[model samples]
Target chain A: MSFLEVRDLSVRLKGGGPLLRNVSLTVAAGEVRGLVGESGAGKSMIGKAILGILPRSVEISSGAIVLDGTDLLTLPPAMRRQRVGATCALIPQDPLTALNPSRRIGPQITDRLVDILGWKRAEAEARARALLHEVQIADPDRVLRQYPHELSGGMRQRILIASAFAAEPRLIVADEPTTALDVTVQKQILKLIAGLQARHGTALLFVTHDLGVVSKVCQSLSVLYSGKVVEDTDVARFFAGPAHPYSAALLAATPKYTDPTAGLNPVPEAVIAAVRAEVENG
Target chain B: MTLVRTLLLRLMTTAVTLFGVAVIVFFVIRVVPGNPVAMMLPPGATAEDVARLTALYGLDKSIPQQFVIWGAGVLHGDFGTSITLRQPVLALVLGRLPATLELSVLALVMAVLMGGAAALTGTRLRETRVEGGIDVANGMALSVPDFLWGLVLILVFGVLLPVFQISGRVTPSLHLPFVTNFYLVESLVRLRFDLTRDLLAHMFLPAFALAIPLAAIIGQLLKQSLKETMHLDYVTLARTQGYSEARVIWREALPNAILPTLTLVGVQFTFLIGGTVIIERLFSYEGLGNMAIDAVINRDLPLIQGIVILFAVIFTGVNLVVDLTYAALNPRLRHG
Candidate 1:
């Protein structure tokens, strides 16, 4: 079994049909796993389930999210939160709103460390300052006093990344972490995440609809469609030669900067047809 | 320059509008029939006495002359003698003002605390049937007028329990707690805790009546704002960041949700003034509402005008305070 293993995980929304259907995944120790899917394909849902942060409407009908030999689904919410902070963390999609707007950045970062990790305020604050510096934020002390709204989009994203890194979790979930940033900022954030994950040897579940994002950091990739994993492969195999038609289409759809003369590739008819059939069935 | 310009403009507009309304209300009062001097006179007085009374009361003057004299006196800080009290109107108002102020302030404090507590509970249980029931109860309580609620409260707390006095100002023997012994520097001041309870008991009818509508409106506002705040990206991130439900809703959600309610509080404060009239009459509690009604009935134009001006000033002051609070709660409005 992998270090963190999910088996037969399913989520059904209230008054709605299955959101995830028997989806399973594994993240070996210190490896980056990519989850690629369309907007409603339950990529984020999988991340939420792993962290035990599912919405009130959704129920884990049948699943076992085993992290380092413990069944996460069986733990109480408070215990689960402790586990999440010490063992795993989530980098949410939009940095612009990922932080509490009413609080200064430094206190926001230190609060979690003091409560969840039992780090004293001074130690936690020092850690926060160091994390900010690591994330390349200029004038870490100044940023500490400033509210979320005071920072630029790129700066906010960096701060969020530093927050996720602050606890030194064993596993981190970056769910479209840089999707809301500009292209240049997106590259910087991805590089930052990649570098941090490498240095700390923490497992990463990087969820994105864009295959290009996964290609940079993921050691392994899983392609999902209609709440099912359609393909699972190593990064080199997945990109160099994709097995699933959906995977191939996703890769083809992704724009390439090196080949500027190449026109955009239209989406594959097979994937489109499959998606249409799924939509029509519902 | 910028702040002063805006403040000047706002003051000018408010003053002009208040002046127009005051003048119209003044004329409307004058047009109504019963004479102040007549109300004052004994039944079998002579025609010469009535004439002398009219001249003495300044009722014999032309409308413009009367207005000029009244307005000039107001400018010079003189609110003429009251027809009923036969003392300077300002002195009478000032004397009675503290009583009304004490009642209004106490009732408002109770209303804020009760309405806030109820709103917190309601929003916390919004998904449950109990929350729905509480919401309906709030709406029903609010829909019934303050006088009716006051009567119901009086029946329950006053007649049935017999714990509280039915009608009166603070018991003359009762001294307020905490502030009585300022001379004792080292020790904490002695307090009559029972007196505090007694005061609150007396406040029950008026405060509950006032708080019902405020709570209903606040509950509705709170639920809407909480729902919106919960949907915001920050809240979602907080959840993923592992904040407990209470922390997420209270610390993260409630502060942002309170922005709209601050505006509502100002408008409701004005409503409270209007509501006091029926409540005071129903309970036979002496307050500004009762005084204003008496002045209107006796057709004491100067007293009515003075009371009206007092109310306008209070209403404007409440609005100014609310605006200042709005700037504090919402950063966008601060500089703007």
Candidate 2:
């Protein structure tokens, strides 16, 4: 069995349509997986479900999520939380949203290290400084002491990544970690994640809509469409020759830089024509 | 820091406007035209007696000179002699000042507790079906005037039960820190549980009355701000970080939401002092509000001017203190 195995996971929100339906995937130890989909395709929902961080109205209708061979669905909330912090950590999309705005960045990062990672205050502080430096943040000490608001968007994102790494969890689920950063910073953050994952041999569930990023970090990829996984395959094979029709259409949609003069390749006229038919039927 | 600057500018505007209000009130009182000489004289008194009295009281002096004399008296801590009380205005104001201070302080405590409890309950009840009922109660409490509440309280606690007195000296006062020397002295001489209850009882009605408006205002403010804070991204992040729901609310949401409430509390301090007039009169609780009332009714010009100016200064001072607190509690307001 994989280290973390999700079997037939389904999620539905009250008053909203099904967010995820019978989506199943697995992550082995030291493996990085990419869950890719268009917007509103339940990619983030899958990340949230694994962590038991769903919104109040959403329910996991049917699923068995086993972490380290223990069913995550069977454990109580408190136990689940303990496992989450100590075994897994989440890096949310926006750094500002992820960090407490009122707390100084250093204490915010170090406190998590001490509390969840069981590092002493001094050790945590030192680690926090080093982590900030590791993330390429300038004036690590000053940035650590400053509030999240005082730092630029990219700086805050780096600080968040440092805090996530402070936990040293077995698995890290990064939900659009690089979305809020600029192009330059995004690449840097991704490289940092890749380096960290390699150093620690940590499994990662990298959730994003950007296929280029998925191609960079992931060994396996799951393509979701309308609350279901349309394709799940090894990243190399899938990218080499996508078998699913939707996957083919998505790949075709990515603009080719080789032909700059050509208008961006639109999804094939046949695929669009089929979607229009489905909508018209309802 | 910019938020602090914005708050300071608003406070300064409030202070300047309050000064203008004080000046206008000063002039308007004098414009009422009946001479103190005519008002004080016996109906059968001869014209000579009236003329002599007018000169003695400086009623014959020009309005600006009278104002100057009144202002000087204010600066010198002499608000002239009260015609009705047959005492110096300063003495009367001071005598009643302590009582009003006690009432206002008690009311502030009560209001904070009441409003805080209501806000906490309302915040919790938001997801429950009973939220509408609690909202209605808050609205009702907010809509009713303070004096009317005092009257209702008197009827229930005073007129009916007759168990607790509706109004009088703060009964069986227990020592309060830094405020009442007598209570502190007594408490130090002998520590007793009975004294505490007596003090709490004495503070009950007026405090409850004063607290109604404050609590209503605070509860509404807290509930709205807390609701907004709950929606903030950090709260969601805290939950996702494997923190418990209670910890998320207390550690993350409460601290972030409380800054505005603290600022409002500081500003409310001044409003409480101002609002206590009707409360003091209704319960006959001696306080600054009561003193202001006596000054107005007795046409004690110097006393009225002094009380108004004092309140204006205190209000502005309280606002400045609140602004400083904002910088302390909210890092976003400070680090910038």
What Cα-based lDDT does every candidate model obtain? Answer: 0.79, 0.77
Evaluated on CA atoms against the true complex, candidate 2 attains a DockQ of 0.59
lDDT of 1 by residue, B1-336 (tens): 555776788789788877876777667777878888888889998999999999987879987788778878888989787788667877666655555565666667776776677667776676898778877877886788777778788898888987766675445576554432221111122455565565555555776676677767777777778877887777776676677877778878888888888799889888887787667666566666777888888878777887787778778878877877777676555445
After superposing candidate 1 on the true structure, give the runs of residues whose Cα lies further than 4 Å from its correct spot: A271-282, B1-18, B44-46, B172-195
Compose the digit string of candidate 2's lDDT tens values, residues A1-282.
588888888888886667787888999998999999888889999988888788778898888898999998899889898787678878889876777888888777776566656779999899888888888877988887788777778788888777777777788889999998888889988998898889878899999988889889999988887678878899999889898777888877776678879776666778756643542342
lDDT tens digits, residue span A1-282, model 1: 577898989889877888887888999989999999889989999998998777778998888999989998999988887677677888889887777766678878888788767889999999999999999987999999887778899999898888888888888888999889898888999999999999888899999988877878999988888787878899999878898777788788888889999989867887878855753463
Q: Is the docking of candidate 2 incorrect, acceptable, medium or high quality?
A: medium
Worst 10 residues of 1 chain B by lDDT: B180-189
| Candidate no. 1 TM-score | 0.92
TM-score (all chains, Cα) for each model = 0.92, 0.90
